[model samples]
Target: MENHEDVDIVIVGAGLAGLTTALALHRLGLRSLVLESSESLRTTGFALTIWTNAWRALDAVGIGDSLRLKSTQMKGFKIASPDTGLFTSEQALDKDGKFKGYESRCVRRKDLLEALVDELPPSTVRYSSKVANIEELDRFKLVHLADGSILKAKVLIGCDGVKSVVAKWLGLGAPVRVGRSAIRGLVEFPNGSGLDPMFHVNFGGGVRFGFVPVDEKSVYWFFTFTPSQVPSYEEDWKENPMKMKQFILSRINKMPQHAQDVVEKTSLSSISIAPLKFRLPWNILFGNIVKDNVTVAGDALHPMTPDIGQGGCSSLEDSVVLGRCLGEAFLNKSNEEDDEFERIKKGLEKYGKERRWRSFSLISVAYCVGFIQESKGILMTYFRKAWFSSYTPSAFLKMANYDCGNLVS
Candidate 1:
C-alpha cells in the first residue's frame, strides 16, 4: 500500500448515506474523505419515494428546495386491490390531526445523487476506491482500499451498503433476507403520461404493485413478489431480459389499465431486480452496532425491507443524526491532536445511543408490514383489507413526526 494519509473522519461508500454525511460534516466545518467503490457516482436506481422527514433531512444539509424543483409533489397515497378497482383507504400527505404536513416527493435517484455531489467540494469524493479490508487500531481505524492506499482516521463511518465490509469488520452479521424480491423500472412518456400526480398501490395474487408519477413525462413503477429464489446480486437476474420482462408483464398485466400501460412500457434497459434484505432489529438494539470510534450508518447499520419506503429515508436520517453528534463532540473539545481520538469515540457513542431503538423499531414494523402484505392466506387477505389500509397510514404518520433535529450548521 502507498503511504497512509490520515484524516479526522473517513466515510466509506458514496451512496445516499455517505454523500449526506460528507455534506453534513462540511456544513459543520469538518472535512471528510468519502471513498466510493464505483468507478464514478451511481446514476442508476431510477426514482425513490422521499417522505416528509426525508425532505426535512435534505433541507438540514441544504438541497431540499433543489430536489423539490425536480420532484413531483405527492399529496396522498392510495391503497387498494388490483382485482377490484375500489379503493380501500387513502392517506393524505399533510400535517393535521394524526398526520404531519410533510409533503412527500418522488425524485429520480440519479438527480438527487448528482445534487448532493454538486454541493460538495471537487475533492470531497474519491471514485474508483473500494475498501478491501478494515483493521481497527487502539485509537484509529485503518481502512485499506483496493488500490493499495490506506486511509487512517480517528473516526470511521461505514455507509457501504447492505454487503458492507466495514460492518463485517465490526462483527455485525450478514443482512437477513425477507424472502421477497422486487422488479422496478421507470417508464418514460416524453409526451406526458397523462396520469394524476399521486402515489398509488394495488395488492393481489401475493404481489404488490406500485406506481408514482415522478413527473408529467415519466412514471416510476415496481412489482414485488416472493421469488422462487432470491438472486444474490443485481446482475443475477438470470439474464434473459425478455424472460424477466415477460414475467413482470404477466404479473401486472391484469392490474388497472393505467397500471398495465405503465408495465407494458417499462424500459427493458431500466428494469432491474433486487432481493429484499434487512438487518435484524435485535442486532442493532442489543448487538455491537458501534465499537469505539468505528460505527456504521445507512444500510450498513439498518437494512430494512422497503415496503414502507423508509430504508433510504432512514439512511438519510442517519447522516443528519450522525453529523449532529459528531459536530457536538468536536465543538466540545479542542482541535488538539492529542485528544481527537476520544472526541470521535464520544461522538460515535452518542450516535449509537440515539439511533439504536429508532432503527430497530422501524425495521420490525417494516418486516411485519411486508409479511402482512405478502401473506397468501385468505384470513391474511381479509386482515390486510380490513386492517392494514386503516392502520399503516397512521403508523407512517407517527414515523414522519420524528424530527432528526436541525443540523445547526
Candidate 2:
C-alpha cells in the first residue's frame, strides 16, 4: 500500500456535515481535507426549516449571513385537520414580538450546501474521491479511495450519510429502517397564489402533509406515513405521478380546498420517495467514535427524522464542536507532550462526550413528534389537534429555540 504523511484530519463525505466541519476547522486555524464521492453539486431537492439553534451553529462557523440571503424566515405555522377539512390552529413563531430574538428560517437544501462549499478553499475539498475503505494504521488512519490512492491522517471524521463506509469499516454496521416512508417534492406556484410564509401541517388518518414556502414564489412540500407492505421506490413511483397524486388526494380528499389544490398541482417528475428511518439510540453513542485516530460525525452518528428539522442542524453543531475541541487540543499539545496521537485521541473523546447526550435527546424528541403527527384513528386525531392547540406558540418557540451550546456542558 502506498503511504502518505499524516495530516491534521481527514473528512469523508462532502455533504452538509463534511463541509460544515471543514469550515469550522478553518475558523479554528486548522486545515483538513474533504473527500467527496460526487464530482459536482447540484441544486436539487426541497427547502429545509432551520430553527434558532441551527442558525446559532451556522453563525459559529461564520456562514450564517450568506445562508440567510438564500433563505426565507418563517413567521408562523398552522395545523389543519384532514378529516374535518378545517383549520385547527395557527401559531406565529414570532407572535410574542420575539421574532428578532428567536427566529427560524427555511432554505433550499442545495443552496445551503452550495454556500458551505463555497467557503472552503478550492484545494481543501477533493471531489470524485469516493472512499472505499478505512484502515487503522499503527500510528495514523488510512483512507482508501476508489481511484487506487490512499491518504493518511491523524484523525478520520466520517460525515457520510446513513450508510457510512467509515462506520461500517469500524464495525458500526448499517442503520436499521424505522418502518416509515416519506414522499417529498418541490412545487412551484404560479405568481400570486397568495401562499403565506408560514408552514402548513395537514393531518389525516395514518399520514401527515407539510408545506413551507421556499421563497415568495415557490413552495416545498412532503407527505409521510407508515410504509405499506408494498414499497414506494423513486423510480416506479415517478413513472406514475397521477397514481401517487390520487393516493394523496384520496387521503386528504375531505380536507380544505386549498390543501387539495396544492396536491393537484404537484407533478410526478418533481416528486421523490424515501423510506423514513431512525438509527437506534444506543448505536449512536456505541462503538469507538474515535478508534485508532478515526471518528465519525453527523448522520453517521445521530441520524433522525425531519420532524424537528434538526438533522442537518445537529450535524452542523457536531462539526463546529468537534473542530473547536480538536483545535484546542492541537494548540495545547506542548513540545514536551509531543504525542500528537494522544492529543488527537483526547480531542475525539471530548467531542463524543460533549455531543452524544444532546444529539440523542434531539433524536428522541423528534421521533416522538413524528409519531404523534403520523397517528391514525379518530380519537388520536382529536387528541393530537387538542394537544397542539393547548400549547401557546411561545411554548413551541421555546422548544424550537433550544440551543445545543447551552446543553453541551
Candidate 3:
C-alpha cells in the first residue's frame, strides 16, 4: 500500500472515456489522475469512425487537428444487398456539400489514443492501477486500488467500461444483452480490390456484414449475427482467434465472390468478438450517474451497439459536457455566494438530465437498426430495404449531426 494522493478528480480506467475526461479537465485548468489497469496503452485495433458530432467534440478539447493527421475522411455510407449486389440506399458524405460542417474520419484506435496521451503531462495517467473498490466518505471519495493503495478525491469519475466496478459500487450491474454477437477485424487487401472508400453494410438473411476503409491499403470489417446461444468466457475461448472468422465465413458463405474473397483472406488471429449489449437506464447519464460526489461516463454509463459507430463519439461527448458543467461549478464557486459542493452537485444533476434522453435514444435507435439488419423473415427484409431507400438523406445527416453541446444548455 502507498500513501494516498489527493486531487480534484480521480478517473478510473484509461480507455477512451477516461482519457477524454482527463483532457477535458486539463483544459478547464483542473488536474486529474487517471488510473489504468493495463500496464501500457492499447494497440492493434481496427479503425474508429468519428462522425461529425464527435469531430466537433474532439476539436473542443484541442486534439482534433492531431487526429486528422492519422485519419482517412469518409465520404458517406452505402447500404447494399448481398444477394443482388444492388445498392439499397446511398447517402452523400455531405448533404450541403460541406462535409456537413464536420467531416467524418476513420482513424486507427491506437493512433487516436496515442495522440491524446501525448497531449497530457507525465504522471497524469497511472498505469497498472486497477481499482478494486470505492468507499465514499462524507468529505471525500476513497478509491481502493487492487495493489492496496488508496486514493482520495473530491470527485470520482468512473470510465471503467461496461462491467464497471464503480458503477457496481453505486448499484449498477451488467447491461441487458441484445441477443447478438459482433465479430470484427482489421485486415489488408490486395491492390485493385474495387472496395470503395465509403463505409459499406451488406445485409443477408439473419446476418449483416460491413466494411469501412481504414486507409488506402487497409480496411476494417465486421459481422453481426443473431447468436443462438451465448458462450461463457473461458481460457480456451481466448486461444481461438479463428472462431470469429470461421463464424463469419460460415454464415456468409453464400454471398458474392468479392465478399467471400475478403472473408477468406481474414486471419483468425486478427478477429475479436464483442457481445452486443445495451442498458436502458444509461449509467453515466441516467440511473445513478452521480451518487454523492461520484459520477460515471462512456460505456461505464451507456454501452450501445456499434451499428452506428458512435460508441466512442458518445463517450467523447460525455467528457466535453461534463467538463463544461464542472467548469461552471468552479466559476460559480469563485463568486463565494454559493457552496462549491452544492454547485458541482447541481451541475452534474443538470448534465445527467440533459444527456440521458439523447444517449438512451441513440442506444435504442442503434438497437433497432441492428435488429432490422439481422431479421430472418422475407417480409422484414423487404420492409427494411424499402425504408432505407425511402429515408431522406437529410434525415440521416440530421441523426449524424446531433451535437452534445446543444443538449448541455
Candidate 4:
C-alpha cells in the first residue's frame, strides 16, 4: 500500500461532470487528477442543449466565449402534437428581450470536451484508468484500478454517469428506469438544413421527436418512445446502429417531412441509444451522497429523465459549486494534515447540502414532465393536454434560469 500513488483530489469519469470539475478546480489555482475508463475522452453523446445556466458555468471556468463561437444561438422553441395537428411556439429571446441571460445552443459534445481539455494542465486526465474497487484508508481513499495499481486521494468526487461505482460505494440507491428509451443522431446537410434556428419538438402516438440545428451544416435530433411501441423491436437494435436508425425512422413516419429526413440522412456512426433512468428524488433527498470527503456529482447524484434537457447543464453547475466549496476549504486550511482532511470533509458536506434540494427539485420536475409527455392512457392524455395548455413559457424556462454561482466564491 505504501507503493501506491497519491494525489490531492481525484475525480472519476471524464465526462462533462468530471472535466468541468477538473477545470473548475484548475481555475481556482488547485490541481486535480481525473481518471477516465476510456482510452481517450468519452464524447459519445453527439451533442447537448446547453442552456443559459450552463453558459454561466462555462463562463466561470473561462471557456464560454470560445464554445459560443462553435454553435448557433437558439431563437426559441416550438411544440407540436402531430396526432392532433395542434402546434404552439414561444420566443426565448429578442434584441432587447426580458430573458437576457436565458439563451440556449446545441453544442457538439466533442467540442465541449476538447475546450475543457485545452484549458486543463497537461496530463491532468489519465486515460484508460478504470477503478476496480475502493477502500477506506483512514483519512484518505484508496482507489484500486483494473490494471492492478492503487491510487490514494484526500478528496474523491464521482462524476461517473447513472451507474456510478462511487455512488454505489456511497450506498446511494440505483437509478430507476422509466420504461422508455431515446435514440439520438447527428445529420449533416452540405446545402444547409434550411431549418429555423428554433428547436422543433413533436409528440404523439407514444413517440416523441425533436430536432435543432447545431450549425448551418449539421442538425442534432432525438427520438424517445416506449419500447413496446415497436411490434418487432429487438434487443439487437441496441447493438446494431443501422437497425436502430431504421427502427427510429419507422416510428416517426407521421412526423413533419423535415423531421423524417433528418433521421434518414443521419450516418450510422453518429447514432446512439439508451434507456432513460432516474434516481428517485426521495432517494437523493435522504441518500448518503456525501460520506466523509467522498461524494457524487452530475448524473451520479441526480440521474433524471431528459425531458427538461438539464442533464448536462446541472452537471456543469455541480462542478462550479463543488469547486468553490472545496477551494474555500483548501485555501483557508491549517498546516496540520488532519485539519486539512477535516476541512475537506466539511466542504463536501456543504456541497451535498447545497445540491440536495436543487437535485431533488430537478429530478422531480423532469420525471413529471417525461411522465406526462410519454403517458398514452386515455386519462393521462386528458391530463397531459390540460397541463400543456396552461404551461407558460416562463414556467418552462424557470429551471434553466437558475444560477449556480461562481467557482471563486
Candidate 5:
C-alpha cells in the first residue's frame, strides 16, 4: 500500500531553513511540501544566537517581531581567561558597523521553529515522512520515503542538516569533524538570573565556554573543547542528563562561579552534547551544492563550527535567498515541463552561485576563530592575549553584519 504524491516542490527536514523556505514561498503565492522524518517538530538544540543578519531574514519571512518580543537584545560582551588571569574590558556592540543598528538575541530554538511553523499553512508539513532514496527523472525527481510513500517533485530542497542524505545525493560529500565537542544547555532562574543582557565568555584549560541571557529568567550557555580521548560512556551521558552535567562541570571549573552556577541550575533534560563538524571551504567551492532542480540549504549546504554563532543565522539567510530565487522562477514560468526545468535549473544556479562564496567564507572564519581561541601554545597564547583581546570583538561583530535581501526583492 504505497501512497503517491506529485508536488511542485518538496523540502526535506522541517528545520529553521526548511520552514522559512516554505514560508517565503507561501508569501510569494507559491506552495511547497515540507517532509519531516520525525513524528513531530524537533527542537533539539536548546537555543541559538540570532544576529542582525538573521533578524533581517526573520523579518522578511514575517516572524521577526514575534521572536523579538520573546527574547532580549544583547548589548555587548566581555572576554576573560582563568588560566592566565587575562581579563579583557567589556566592549559595547557596534551599532553603526556594516549593518546599522546592531542587534542580537539568544532565541530558544523552539520559539524560532514555532514562529516559522505558525506562518505556514496547515498540512504544509508532513511529519513521520523520511526520505529514503531519490532518483532524478527527465522532468521531475522521485523521492522515496521509508513509509512506502513516493513523492514526485518538480523541485527538491534539502535542509536535512549535518548528516544530510540529500547533500550526499547532490555529491556534496560529508561534513568534516573538527576534533572538538560542544555541550549546550538552557537553564532558567524562576525568580531571575540577575544577569545583564550581554555575552560572557571564558577561554582556558583547552576549552572555550560562553553564556548569554536569553531573557531575564533564562540563560543559554555552551562549552566547547577538544576531546583527549573517547569517553566510554558517551552514549550513556547523552541519555542521562546528570552525567552530562557532571562531565561539563568537571571540565569548566575555571569558569566564573556564576557561569558554573548556571550549569548547576540547569535541569537534567535541558542539556545536550555533540561533536562539532564542518564542511571545508574548498569542498563547498568545488562541490555540487546545486544540481539541476535539486539543491540544499542550512547545515546541509554549509555545516560550520558554532564559533561564529552564524550556523542558524546563515541558515535563515539561505531560506530567504533560495525562496526569492525560486519564487522569481515560478512566477514567470510557462506551462511546460521543459521550460519549467530550465527555469528551476537557472534559479537554483543563481542560489548556488550566491551562497558558494558566502558559505566558504563563513566556514573558514568559524574554523579559524575556533582554532585561535581554543588552541593551546605559547604563540597562540600570545595571539589571544594581544591580538584577539583588541581585535576579536570587531572581527566577530563584522561577520553578523550581512544582509540577505528581502523576499519581495
Candidate 6:
C-alpha cells in the first residue's frame, strides 16, 4: 500500500550486474539500495577470465586501471585433445595483429566484486535481506524482504542471478540445463605456480578441461563433462565438499600429469560444482523481461553456457547500457518529480529493447557452442579438431567489437 518506505531505486542483488548498475547510477548522482540475500558479500565463485569488452565496461565506470594491476594479461591461447594427447591449435590471443591487441584478464571473481563495491559509499548494500515477494503498483514497485520489511522504489532492478526470483515473478522460466555439469576450482602454489600465464584447454571424447592463471600464485581450473557421469551429484556433493573434489580428481587422473596436478593442488574449499544452464530465446521472446519500471540484468536476463565465456561479459554490458539509459532519462528532466516515474519507465523500456536481442543471440550461440564441444562421437571429434584449428581471430574480434556506450553525463 502507501505505508512502505520509499527509495529512488532498489537493486535486488549485490552481484556483478547490480554493483555495476549501481556504480553507473552513482556517476549521475543517483543512489540505490542493493539487497543481498546472503549474510555477507558472496566470495564463493572462482576466478573469472574477463574479456576486453568487459574491461571496456569497467573502464567506462572507472575500475580498469585498478583491476589490471591485480591480474595477468593472457598473451597466448591453446586447445588440445586429452583423449589423443594431440594438439588442435595454439596461437597468441593478444590483439597485436588481426586482434589489434584487445587482450583479456583472468582475475579472482571475489576481487572484482569487492572492487566494485568499494567504489560505492559505505552500506550501499544491505546484506541478509532476501526478497520474499514483489508487488507492482500504479507508480512504483514494492519489494517485500524475507526479514518482514517492505520497501517501495521508483524503479526495481533485478540482478538476482540465473534462478532469479524476479524473473520467476515476471513469468520467466527456469534456467535450462544443456546436459553438462562442470567442476571449477582454484589451485594455489605457495612458491608460485609453474604453469604459464596463458589460457590452456583440453578436449576429451565428451568432456572439456581448462585452466587459466589468475595470478602468479594461483590458477583457476574447470572441467565440464557431458551427460554428467555421476547422476544425482548435485545433492551428493552437498553432503561434503571433498566429495566433489574427489569426483573431479577421479576424472582428471588419467589426463596428462600437468592437468592432473592442477586438480591435485586444488583445495576442497575453493571448488564449485553445478550443471551448466542457459535460458532459451523463446523464454525472452514470450516472457516479459520488463514492465513499467521493473527490469532484470545479468544472469537474471541471459543465463548462457560458459562455452563462449560471454555470460559475465554480457551482464557487464547490460549494466553499462541500462545505466546510460536511466542516467540520461534522469538527467534531462523537463519538469517535476511527478513525471520522474514515467521517465524511469521509458528508460527501462529502452534498456530492454537494447539488450533483449543481443542477450538472446549470445545465449543461443553459447548453447550451440556447448553442444558441439560436449558431444561424443568420431565425427564430432574430427569436427572439433578441424573447426577449432580453423577458428580465426575474426571469431573473437566479432565478439569483442561491440561497445556498451559510456555512462551518461
Give every collision pair in model 4: none
- Cα miss at 177, model 3 (Å)? 1.3
Scored against the true structure, residue 241 in model 1 reaches a CA lDDT of: 72
The top-ranked prediction according to lDDT is 5
In the predicted model 2, the residue pairs found to clash are none
Model 5, 1-409: lDDT tens digits are: 2456889999999998999999999999999999999999998899999998999999998899999999999988777764633345687765434434888999999999998888889989999999999987667899999987899999999999998989999898799899999988899999999987888887755788889999999999998988773365577775666876787788667656777899999987788788899998898999999999999999999999998899999999999999999997889756566576788899999999999999999999999988888888888888887778656667677888899999867
TM-score of each: 0.93, 0.91, 0.89, 0.94, 0.94, 0.93
Clashes of each: 4, 0, 2, 0, 0, 3
**Tens digit of lDDT per residue, candidate 4, span 1-409?**
5579989999999999999999999999999999999998887899999988899999999999998899999987777764643346455565536777678999999999999999999989999999999998898899999998888899999998998999999999999898898888899999999988877777656777888899999999998999887645656765555878877777777667777899899988888778899998899988999999899999999999888889999999999999999998899756556588888988989999999999999899987777777777787777656666336345457889989998876
Q: lDDT tens string, model 3, 309-343?
A: 77888888988888888778766566576677777
Candidate 2 per-residue lDDT, tens place, 1-409, comes to: 6756566688988878899889988877789998888887645566677778788888887778988886677888777766576767777756556555777777888888888878888888888999887777778777888888888877788998888888777777577777778878777777744677787877556787878777776678888877672465445556766777777777777767777777778777777778877777776666566665677889887788877677877887888788887886677767555587777778888888888777777778778777777777778778776774334344446546755451122
lDDT of 4 at 372: 71
Across 1-409, the per-residue lDDT of candidate 6 in tens digits comes to: 4468888889989999999999988877888899999988996778878887899999999998999999888886777665654445677755447667576778888999999999998868999999999987777778998878999888888999997888888788888888888888898889888777777777656777889988888899888886457777777778877777777667656666776788887877777777788898888776789988888999999998887777888889999998898886778777566478778878888998989888888888777766777777888878876775346334544676678878863
- Candidate 5 wrong stretches, greater than 4 Å: 1-3, 84-87, 94-100, 229-243, 333-338
> What lDDT does candidate 2 reach at residue 61?
79
Q: Give the 10-residue window scoring lowest on summed lDDT in candidate 2.
A: 388-397
What TM-score would you give candidate 1 relative to the actual structure? 0.93
The reply for model 6, stretches above 4 Å from the true place, is: 86-88, 231-255, 335-338, 392-397
| lDDT (Cα, 0-100) at 175 in candidate 3 | 82
Per-residue lDDT for 183-277 in model 1, tens only? Answer: 89999987899887767887656788889999888899988888763344344456557677776667766556777788788778978788789
